[model samples]
Target: MKNTLSRLKYLYRKASRAGADYYNAPYRAAIARARREEDDLFMLLVFSEMMGIPNPAGWYCMELQPLMLERFHDWHTRMGMERSPLDNFRCC
Candidate 1:
């Protein structure tokens, strides 16, 4: 796992363009892992990437980021989590 993340970091640094090489492959895995850990960071990365938002980490950055994020949120809500952050962070 450490090597995987290290490889990702190396690739990220070696990458030329920003949005062009958003995610390779392991980065996607890292994002999925990250999602299981936290909702805010995961959603933020997914939403930002799907909307073409620039992210240096390139972690939650894939063409299907939007769909995955939606599914993740749905699953989370179904599991009894709140979704009030969409309207206002303060509300949650």
Candidate 2:
């Protein structure tokens, strides 16, 4: 778990520097159905801190699938591998 956490830290650093966001658009449409509350904001701040970004001035369960997909795509592309849909292991 420690190794995974450390690896995640590296990925988070890379992602943050690349301007990735948990609150990106597809995420917003999924999770921001209502006004963000206090606890939600706290989680955002924590995530922001872990990713080494400025504490989000706020919080919002964010529908996380889209950004997750985007990241997979981004990584695949950057690797110069042929992009695949990652669904049932099909080609993209």
Candidate 3:
């Protein structure tokens, strides 16, 4: 009887996790998409000069390029871009 009770407890925990995951799937996806969009906008701002859109803060943005380099590949992939928009800059 003790073994059976332990088994039941484990099953209950598993089921609760599964149910929570199912219910939260849409919210998780929306949040992920929103984060990706936010990252993309930040990338655009950092690389605006590459797009021929003269950025007023272009000089300040240059310093952040090295720090943002690692995320560039993943960001472009998430945006469905074939290559980095700043390919000409080659900082990534």
For each candidate, give its TM-score against the true structure.
0.25, 0.22, 0.59
Q: Using TM-score as the measure, which candidate wins?
A: 3
Ten residues in sequence with the least summed lDDT for candidate 3: 83-92
Candidates sorted on lDDT, descending:
3, 1, 2
What lDDT score belongs to each candidate, Candidate 1 first?
0.59, 0.50, 0.84
lDDT of 2 by residue, 1-92 (tens): 99999999999898886675644756775555443344344433433533456644423313443444434444445446675524443335
1 against 3, candidate with superior lDDT:
3
| Top candidate (lDDT) | 3
Candidate 3 residue spans exceeding 4 A from truth: 1-26, 79-81
Candidate 1 displacement at residue 53 in angstroms: 3.6
The TM-score of predicted model 1 comes to: 0.25
Better of 2 and 3 by TM-score: 3
Candidate 3 total steric clashes: 0
Candidate 2: residue 57 Cα off by (Å): 29
